[model samples]
Target chain A: MQGREILFIVLSLVACFAGLGVVLAKHPIKSALSLVVNMFSIAFLYFTLEANMLGITQIMVYVGAIMVLFLFVVMLLNIGSDRSGMKILDLKLVPAILIALLMFSLISFQVLYPLFGMQYPVADEGFGSPEAIGKSLFSQYVLPFEVASVLLLVGIVGAILLARRKA
Target chain B: MLEEFISNLHPVLAIFVRIICFSGIAIMFVPIQVWWERRLLGWMQDRVGPNRVGPFGLLQPVADAIKLFLKEDHVPSGVDKFIYYLAPILAFLPAFALGGTMPWAPAEGLYGLLTPVADINIGVLYVLAISSLGSYGVVLAGYAGNNKYSLLGGLRASAQLISYELAMTVSLAAIILVTGSLRMSEVVSYQTGPLWGIFPYIQNWNLLTPTGLVAGVIFFICAIAETNRAPFDLPEAESELIGGYHTEYSSFKFGLFFLSEYAARFVFSGVFATIFLGGYNMLPVRWDILAVDFPGWSEWFYFMHSANYWLSPVAFIAKCFLGFTVFVWVRATLPRLRYDQLMSIGWKSLLPAAVANFIVVAVWIMVTNLYGMIAGYASLVVSAIILLVLYLNIKAVGFNESTSTKRRIKMAKFNLKENEESN
Candidate 1:
C-alpha cells in the first residue's frame, strides 16, 4: 500500500476501535466520549475525501456541540452510577439487541445489493470538494437546506415549550 | 537548511511541523501564562509573588509543573475510573483542536514556509464549535465524580454556557454581517481599512468607529462571560461551592482543569484578535499604504500577503497573550456576580443586546449600501435609551418584598413555638 493508504488504514482502525469502545464502555459519559472519538475519525475520513468543510462541520456540530449537550444532559441527570444497571438491562436489552440486529441486517442487505450491480459514477472533478458541496447545496439541495432550517426551528420551539413550567 | 529539509521530506515533515507547532504553542503557553498571571496578580495586590522559585520567579511555573508531576494521583471510590481519568484530556483537547483554525498572522514569503497549523477557511466557525465542546470535560468530571456539589456546578456550567452561547452567536453574526464572510482571515482583511461613516469626511478603523467599538466591547464582555471568568464564574465559585465542578479532582487531573482554563483563555483571545484587532494586520491603513507607496513592498509585507503562512502563528500567539492579559486583568478587578444576577445578565441583558446588535449591524450594512449613508448612530442612540430605561425599571421594582416579609414572619412564629415548647 502507498504511505497515505497505510496512514488511512491506521486511522480507520483507531476509529473503529474507538467506536466499539463507545458501545462497550459501561459509563454513559465514557460512551459519549468514545462517540466523540468516532466522530473525529469520521471527520478525518471526510478530510481524506477532500471534504474539508464537511470534516470541520462534522467535528463542530457533532463532536463539539451535540456531544457537549449530550454530556450536559448525562451529567444533569446523574444516571451513570446507579445500581439499576441490571434492572435496565433486564427491561430493555433483549428487545433492543434484536431490533438493532434486524436493522443492521436490513441496511447491510440494501448496501450489498446496490454494490453488486450498480457502478458508481465518477465525477470529472473531485467528488467531495468544498466547491462541489457548495454547488450542490445551493442548486439541487437548496430546498432541502431551507427545509432543514424550518425543522431546526420547530425543534427549538418544541424544546422550549417542553422545558417551560406551566403557569 | 529548512528548505532542504522541506524539499527532501515534504509530507512526513509537514505532519511533524503541525505537531511541533501546535504542541509547542500549547505546552509553552501553559507555563508562561501561569507565571504571567502570578506576577500580574502580585503586582495588583502589592506583594512579591513566587520570588523564591528562581530568578525573580521566572522559573516559578517550571517549579509548579514539577510539583504537579510529583504529586500523588488519587481516585475516589465509586467513581467511573475511565471517565474520571479521560475528563482532563477532553478538557485540554478542544483548546488544541480549536487553535487549528485561528489565522495568527499573514502568510509570509514565497512558498509559505511558516503557517502555524491548520488554516481552514471556516476558521471562526471551527473555533466556536471546538470551544463549545469544552463544556463536555467539566460535565463529565462532575458526573463521574458522583458528587452533589460537582453535579450542581456542572448543571450551572451547562446552563450558563448554553444561555450565553445565543448571545455569543448573535454577536458573531453581527461581525460576520460586517465582514460578509465566515472565514477569520477574510473578516480580518475587511477590517484592515478605515471604515467610512455616514459623513463623507469622517472615516476610522472599526475599533475607532462607533458601531465597531460597541460591537467589539460587547464581544469582549461576552467572551469573558462565555469563558466562565470571574464575576461570571459561578460554575467554579470557590467560596460557595468549594472549588465547584472539579472539587473531587486532585493531582494531574486537577492540573488538566487548570490547563484547559488557561488554554481556552488563550484561544478566545486569538479569536478576539482575529475578529476585532484585524488579525495579523499591524495597522488599519497598512494594506492601503502598501498598495500606494512602495507597492512592491506589498509582496514582502508579512501582514498582507503571507499571513497564515509564516508570521500568522506569531501574530496569533501575541494576540492570545494580549487576550490572556485582558482575562487576568478582569479577574483581578471584577467581583463575582451573584448567581441570580449572572442568570439575568445572560438571559435578560446580554441576550437582548446581542440580538439588537445583530439586527442593527445587519440593517446598517444594508442601509449603507442602498442609501450611501448608514443610520447606525441613530440605532445606537435608540439602544442606549432602551437599556437605560430597562435599568431604571429594574432598580425601581427590586426583589419580591411581599415574599421576604412573609418569610421573616414565618421565621419569628417558628422561634416563638420553639420557646413555648422549651418552657
Candidate 2:
C-alpha cells in the first residue's frame, strides 16, 4: 500500500476503536467524548478521501456544535455513573440492536457496496468545494434540502416546547 | 552563504522550520504581551502595576513562570487523577495548535513552505474546528476538579461558547460570501490594493467595507466572548467564582491555564487581523507603481515580490500587536458583564444581526452583479430601512431583556429611626 493509504487505514482503525468506546463507556460524558474522538477520526477519513469541505463541515458541525450541545446537556444533567454492563444486553435492547444491524447491512449491500452496476467514487477537480456543494444544494437537491431544513425547524420547535415549563 | 543555505533547504524540513520558528516567536511574545497588558492597563487604570521585577517589569512573566515551576504540584485527594492532569494539557495544546492553519508569510521563501504549517483547503474551517474544541479543556478541567465552582465555570463556558459560535459563524459566513473562498490566503489576497477596488488611497481591509464593517463588529464581539475576555468573562469572573474552573488547579497547571489564555488571545487577534485587517499587506496601495517609477529599486521589488515569504509576516505581526492592544484596551475599559446580560447579547442581539447582515451582503452582491452599482445602492438602502424597522419592532416587542439591575435590594424597609439610632 502507499503511504497515504496506510495512514488512512490507521485512522480508520482508530475511528472504529473510538466508536466502540462510545458504546462501551458507562459514563455518559465519557461516551460523548468517545463520540467526539469518533467524529474527529471520521473527519480525518474524509480528509483522506480528499473531501476537505466535507471533512471540515464534519468537524465544525458535529465536533464543534453538536458535541458541544451533547457535552452541555451531559454536564448539566450530571449523569450518575453506571456499572450495569448487562443492562445493555437486556431484552429491550436486543431487538433494537438487531434491527439497527440489519438496516446497516442492508444499506451496505444496496447502496454502499455498488451492487447494482454502480461505480466506485473518486474525487474530481472541485469535487468537494464549498462552491460545488452550494451549487448542487441549490440546484439539484433544492427541494429535499429545503424540506430537510423545514424538518429541522420543526424539531427545534418541538424541543423548545418540550423544554418549556407551563406558566 | 545564507541565500545558498536558504535555497538548499528541503521542502518538508522548511515547513518544520517555519512551524517551529513561528511558534517560538509567538511563544516569546506571550511574556511581552503580559508585560504590555500590565503597563498599558496600569496607565489606563491609574495604577503602577508590576514595575519591580525588571525594566518596565519585563522579567515579571519569567519570574512568574519560575515561581510556578518551583511551587510543588498538588493534587486534591477527591479529584479524578488522570483527567485532572490531562485537563491543562487539553487546554494548552489546542491553543497552540490554532497556529497550524494560520498563514503567516507568503510562499516566496525556500521550498514554498514559509507561510503556515498546514495550508489545507479548508483553512477557515480548521480554525473554527480547533477553536470549537477549546471548550473541552475547560469543561474537562471543571469536571475532573470535582468542585462545584469549577463545574459552574465549565457549564457557563460551554453555554457561552455555543451561543456565541452561532453569531461568529454567521459573521464568518458573510466574510466567506464576500471573499467567495474558504481558504485563508485567498481571503487575504482579495483584500490587496484599494478599498472595494475603486478608491486608491483607502486600504481594502474588510473593516472598511459597509457590509464588512457590520460583520467585523459582530465578529470582534463574538471573538472576545469566544476567548472569555471581558466583558464576557463569566466563566472565570474572579469576584464570583474565585479561580473558577482552575480553582483546584495549582502551580504549573494553573500556569498552563494562564499561558493558554494569553496565547489564545494573541492568536485570536492574529486571526482577526488576517481576516478583517488585511494580513501582512501594510497599505492597500499597488506596489507596481514604485517598480515602474524608479528603476533603481527593481531588484528590491523583485526580492519583495514574494511578498508573503518575508515582508508580509512582519506586517502581520504588527497588525496582530494592534489587535492585541485593542484586547487590552477593552479589558481595561469595560466591566465584566453579568451572566444573564452576556447570554442575552450572544443569543438575542448578535446572532440575529449577524444573520441579517449576511443575507443583506449576499443580496447586495447579487444585485450589484445583475443591474449595476445603482441598483446595489438602492437595494442596500431598502435593506437598511427594513433592518432599522425590524430592530425597532424587536426592541419595542421587548426582545432585548430588561437591563435594570437586580430587583431585590437588601435594605431593611426604609426605617429611618432605627438607621439613625444605629450610629
- lDDT score, candidate 2, position B95: 82
> Best candidate per DockQ, number?
2
TM-score of each: 0.80, 0.88
Report how far residue B412 has shifted in candidate 1, in Å: 17
**Candidate 1: regions farther than 4 A off:** A2-25, A48-51, A81-110, A116-154, A164-167, B197-206, B287-316, B373-423
Question: What's candidate 1's DockQ score?
Answer: 0.50
Best model number under TM-score: 2
lDDT of 1 by residue, A44-75 (tens): 88777667678878976787677778877777
lDDT by residue (tens digit), candidate 2, A26-112:
778778888998999999898887788899899888988899889888778887567555485578788988899999999999897
For each candidate, the alpha-carbon lDDT, in order, equals 0.73, 0.82
Worst 10 residues of 1 chain B by lDDT: B196-205
